[model samples]
Target: MTTVQPTVVSAEAVDVATRGGAGTARRRPRGSRPFRSPQAQELWGWTFVAVPMLLFLTFVIIPVVMAVVLSFTDYAVIGDPEWVGVENYRRILDDPIFWLALRNTVIYTVMFVPLGVLVALGTALLLNRSSRVVNLFRTLFYIPVVASTVATATIWYWLLNPQSGLFNIVLGWFGIDGPAWLYDSKWAMTAIVLMSVWSGFGTNMLIYLGGLQGIPRELYEAVRIDGANAWQSLRHITLPGLSRTTFLISTLLIIGAFQVFDQAYLLTKGGPGNSTLTVVYYIYNQGFGGLKMGYASALSFVLFLIIAVFSILNFRLTSRRQS
Candidate 1:
């Protein structure tokens, strides 16, 4: 039988077809570009972020800058601004109402933040065990979180009414006279603070529950093996594990407490001689009610500074504690 042997191609012929016989050299299409370098890739990455950066500048940075500028002026809504320098700030510092508002804000924050954290932690501990009903209970607790603050405030206002109110009726059983909650200067802010704690605790509770669940069971087992009781396990293992979540929740609650307005507004209107007047409430009255826009801007920026300082301090403390 006759067999055909395959022809061996010459190197020169292969080079003509493949650009080079070494099989390394190849020409790309004319219009195509090569891969980017690391620096180029990073430039492109930041290019993609340009739109978001611009949006943030427009929405947040510009508005803040404008407010700062306005704060240095005496601008009302109807007229042009006259530059007043530190006059508005001086007025704020000298204002007794401002002092009262600050005091009330501090009191409200002190009352609400710890109470909210403790309540959330306690509730989360109680609900940490796995069960089908736990999810249902979680949803029930979360209802207030999703509900409107105005609606909740309105409901609480009625419930806290001194005469013919459910809260007083409950207090009546103990033969205690329930003071006018929203009407009395003594009880108005306290009532609002309590309601705020109740309304907000659910959200923090869910967060703590998540944190608790994330801890490995083996750690608890090891603790038990070491003869650690439940309290010891919680203190050494659970709490330390939950540090990040606690820090985050506490920071948020503190900020929220400082910015308290809705409950005070809807329930008390900072009434009974401005006793329950919070910083934000005062800002609202100054800007909108009194039409001192420039002065209000100053007040707002002061509040912003206060919140920023506290938030930074909390973060630093939390980081130190964690480390």
Candidate 2:
């Protein structure tokens, strides 16, 4: 009788613990489906990813494929596409205007990249402080980036006026005559370069600020304790630390410089003997203006090649220097 009572009491205790006095959830059956299977989870993940993948395939991949196919054919949007094989590619070799546009683009890239980097770095260094005024100034500098390109170009148009522009007015203060910027071919490109540097450097400056913040303040303090002057500190600590940032900014600048169109289109309109005719502008003129879509596609691929080559070279050079 005692043995049976003890067994019964133990069974009751085990039952109560298993029930957890109604505060605990009931254990699910072994075959219950409260959670998804691995395959179901995987399918849901793919369902979400498929949306963007579908859009990319429909827009980007399809258009690129179509462009490649169309580059070998003559299509003017109205007429049926006629196959021309390598004729368009061959014609590019003899296209003088294309060559001129390429040369002009090269010149713009050369002038803009270094100047843009310097301006952005300088502005970032100036604004790399913690104060209300400095924050306000940073916002002010970034205003140009948020402003519409057309609006910025319009503002610059008035500023670059030959006779009564703000630029010439400022030059008059020093008794130096400012050249007719947009009107004169010699100065037209220079004007474009200046405007580009001003309008685009704001973004680069923000990027530099991010990089600057990432750099350890301890290094600066260490250098100061070692009797390093401002310039020396910048040369050793600041410059070396920002090498990656410089590489990124310069790469972006190079890409944008090569594909310059909006500023030249809005400001110069490729005027004054086509001096400011960039490759992208020429491509625009060819495709839409002249209705030579096939040729334009060919030119686009050529420009793609050029940009790729330059980008690779930049990466290699920057990597070598860093190493």
Candidate 3:
């Protein structure tokens, strides 16, 4: 048998090999630092958002809070403010002018909201089917929105003049006398409402158009295949689908109507015995003309509350209807 000699094992050699392996393993970079914790990531995200949040709070939230506080005080620009509690609100409650303004605002909203929605929906429907000149028609409709309100109001003022207005001229051709539009109290608000509707309908129309496009085409096709007529399809599918947009548009229109000032200010100046005095125009007169800052703030707060309540009611009604 060949001489079987055990290989000599050296302590120094084993130690050297073990130390070398350990050194190599320690020198190799770990694959990447373990991913940052979710908590850390969330902290960084909030840190980035803090700046915009601060700006919004500073500009919007603080102003609203300040207004709310001011609403309860008797503040004049040149004097110290006196806390009056709910006196301003009581005064508003008893003021016939305030009631008139409120009534006018309501009338305007009731008349304009439905009319605006109807016109916008009609325009959107017509445009939805038009492939050619659709953009052109949209631009045409949107022109009034982009145009200067003052300029539009001025032009309409001229067009509704009792004597030389184009409308009256047309009325003359029809052997009918055109009533004074801006001069007559009865027609002043009506004329302004008409102008406002014309100016504002395009915005709501665009919104409705977007809503219409978002609706799935397959629904219409299915309804048609099921022998549904256009009116039925519109009633069941279009109305239901567009409900949210309708609510939004109507709410916005109502709010806007309550704040009607520019047209009234420029065209009628709340003339014909203040028949066209909107709440905002009243506040403006109080604040700027009469220099009743506190009173104006109070009026503004009242308007704010009205808007809030109306919005809440609208939301509740819409929710109930949907349910």
Candidate 4:
């Protein structure tokens, strides 16, 4: 204790030592700073985005650019692409098969979109009440959406079989002869539309459910207090509340309808005189089957324009209604 002479610490030593103990001075390098600098932040941000941006450029942008360039040429998956100006696009106008496919696609959209919206809304309305059984039904209905499209097409193929099928057998109970569904051109597209609606409506139903939940319970309570019936509440409150959701679902339905391929391809093969030949299927036939890549690209662009126009129209109509 005596040896621990009253040592006076120098200001320099005190400055270098931590409060708890003496240690080596830990000064940052001259002009160096923490990572909070704007330059550092921007560096990290770019590092995060670089991979995704690269991928998008590689897969999406490059392919789209290539398709545009190829659309103006004659590429048949063989030899060099020959420059053909707008010959492919001009050919589209004179192609009766193209017009037929476009007509079928429009018909399918008209039937599928409205029916899909109604079914989704109706299911969502029915299941809005919270209950375990209702949750179970929701899960069951969504199963079809997750199921393989090929499997769904296969199931419907048998279901619509003319001689020995569930649909015809059920109709016979009412003393009604069901038409040959996939075999007859008249009913083939209708049969495909029904299958499509059944397979896809579950997704839109979930979307409607989300929209329903977002509507304030207070609104429903207020309507009920004023003696509003269920239908009246639905008409005044529910429908209006779900208008945006309806528009979104309808737009998606319209796009998918225009791109209809799987069911028509699997069940009908555009058969019975190309009754169910959708635009996408025709595009496929030209691209791969017929090996006319350039024409397929032109058709694809045309379809894209159609989908864009319809989606824009849908948005405008929805906005007008909301206003």
Q: TM-score winner among the candidates?
A: 4
Candidate 2 residue-wise lDDT, 1-323, digit = tens: 88789989778657757777453234444553546699888998999999999999999999999889889999898889999999999999999999999999999999999999999999999999888899899999988888777998999999989888999999999999999999999999999999988888899999999999999999999999999999999999998889999999999988888999999999999977999999999999989999999999999999989988998898898788776
What is candidate 4's lDDT per residue for 1-323, written digit by digit as tens? Answer: 65454344345445545443323324534564433689888999999999999999999999999889889999999999999999999999999999999999999998988999999999899899978899999999888898788999999989988889999999999999999999999999999989998998899999999999999999999999999999999989999999989988988888888999988899999988999999999999999999999999999999999999999998998889887
TM-score of 2: 0.88
lDDT of each: 0.88, 0.91, 0.85, 0.90
RMSD of 3: 13.2
Rank candidates, TM-score, best first.
4, 2, 1, 3
Steric collisions counted per model: 0, 0, 0, 0
Off by over 4 Å in 4: 1-33
Pairs clashing in candidate 1? none
Locate the minimum summed-lDDT window of 10 residues in model 3.
1-10
Determine which window of 10 residues in candidate 1 has minimal summed lDDT: 1-10
User: Could you give candidate 1's per-residue lDDT for residues 131-167 as a string of tens digits?
Assistant: 9899898888777877688989878978997998899
Q: What TM-score fits each model? A: 0.83, 0.88, 0.83, 0.88
Ranking by lDDT: 2, 4, 1, 3
Q: Pick the candidate with the highest lDDT.
A: 2
What global local distance difference test value does model 3 have?
A: 0.85
